[model samples]
Target: MAQTADDAKYLWQKKLDNGHIRIGFNDVAHQEIGEISFAKFPDNLTEVKLGDVILSIEGAKAVSEVHTPVAGKVAKVNVALKDHPEYLESSDEDKNWVVELF
Candidate 1:
């Protein structure tokens, strides 16, 4: 089911690392959806607007579309998730980030 950005945690900014901004689902979203099993991220990107669907996540409970919490140029994507999506469940929130923005 599609819901407005207002009702979802969708995505959030993790602390700056080497100046790159990390983006991922907030704690509430991870807890609500359970363990993540798969993820799909954007390809050949330039920029993203606020609320843009940055990636799609499939969890133990349900599939969800995660949106960009802020607008910025796309730096790179976490391609590692394609094979080990379980990283999203890491105790370290930074490991769960799906996108990096500049």
Candidate 2:
């Protein structure tokens, strides 16, 4: 079944820009994980040595870890998303990226 924007929880896509990869969890993650209550991460902009636990998100049901898909420097974390966790559950692709690497 095709998921219309309204029917989907989140979406993610890759971009080729200076070796940076953006990752976001779609509405499905939000719906499955429930409200996000907490987040854990290494020290700011810590070098992620490939396949490391970069961060973790705590939802109402469980805490999930966000891994470093590839070895790179953690460029930016979406503080906005951290403040407004519900956005993770309802945003379209245009507004749903959780992290960016450089």
Candidate 3:
């Protein structure tokens, strides 16, 4: 596991067994965004570069944009969030992950 941001407030990276990379948010990010109300993600984006906004999470406190940490093709998204947005606050770090980049 790897983390960006001095505070580790949001971003994390992990290399999978297949040598692909995955990036997502940590628990602290959810705290910063407060209670999650909604989330939006691009439907047809198969590739992304570092700093690309892959997702946007809206919460009671504010709307937070989730960026890619490295250039890669998107492998999957946590579709569960579409119905259970509250998981951003209630789920563990692994479960709260918004997307998987590979």
TM-score of each: 0.80, 0.67, 0.80
How accurate locally is residue 92 in candidate 3, as Cα lDDT from 0 to 100?
Answer: 71
lDDT of 1 by residue, 1-102 (tens): 833333245556765847878886566776777898888776665698887877777888877777777778888788888898888777566577788888
- RMSD (Å) of each candidate, 1 decimal: 2.5, 7.4, 5.2
RMSD score of candidate 1 (Å): 2.5
The runs of at least 3 residues in candidate 3 whose Cα sits more than 4 Å from the true structure, single-residue gaps closed, are 1-8
* Candidate No. with top lDDT: 1
- Provide the lDDT at 73 for model 1: 88
Error of 3 at 43 (Å): 3.1
Model 2 agreement with the true structure over 1-102: per-residue lDDT tens digits: 211222123335466466777767766777777887765555665577655665566778666666655666667776666676655666665455666777
Q: Measured by C-alpha RMSD in angstroms, how accurate is candidate 3?
A: 5.2
Model 3: colliding residue pairs: none
- Candidate 2's displacement at residue 6, Å, is 24
